[model samples]
Target: MNLVLMPMWLLSGSVFPASEAAGWMRVVIAINPLSWPTDALRGSVLGEPAGVFAWAGAAAF
Candidate 1:
């Protein structure tokens, strides 16, 4: 599972902002399940409002 999950975590934008990713990479980031909670937590810590999609994605998992 590390093989699958590790890449997902790496693509989750936890290390870098998704905005800085290339177009195709951004698409990968968008589909990564981990990105949702990462984005939600990042937004909470940064005092930015998390998007509805972020919450929904997190809740889905």
Candidate 2:
């Protein structure tokens, strides 16, 4: 599972949040399933803006 999720994790900006990454990387992270949950969780815990669209994307999947 870890191996299977590795690409998503790396692309999701978990190690280096989008803010510090390149524009292309941010674009990739935006579409990564891993990023959605990570962003949502961060938003909830930090009271920041959540990745609302992530729920829709998850639903689609």
Candidate 3:
């Protein structure tokens, strides 16, 4: 599962800010199931509140 999980992890905004990603890559990040949890954790660690969409995405997974 490394092949799948690795790419998902990379695309989940964990390696770089999602905002800096290309438009198409942002779309990919949005669809990645791992992005939500990664966002939530990042927000928590940074003391930034996660948006509603992040919570919703986390819940969805």
Candidate 2, overall lDDT? Answer: 0.76
Task: List model 2 lDDT by residue over 1-61, tens digit each.
Answer: 9887888878876688789988888888887877877776677779887765865654555
| Models ranked on TM-score | 1, 3, 2
Q: Which structure is stronger by TM-score: 1 or 3?
A: 1
lDDT, candidate 3, 1-61, per-residue tens: 9989899999999999999999999999998989998898888889999888888888888
Over 4 Å off, model 2: 1-4, 57-61
Best by TM-score: 1
**What are the lDDT figures for the candidates, one per model?**
0.93, 0.76, 0.92
lDDT of 1 by residue, 1-61 (tens): 9999889989999989999999999999998999999998888899999999898888998
Backbone collision count in every prediction?
A: 0, 0, 0
Q: Once all C-alphas are superposed, what RMSD does model 2 give against the true structure?
A: 2.4
By lDDT, the better pick of 1 and 2 is 1
Q: Which residue ranges in model 3 land beyond 4 Å of their true spot?
A: none
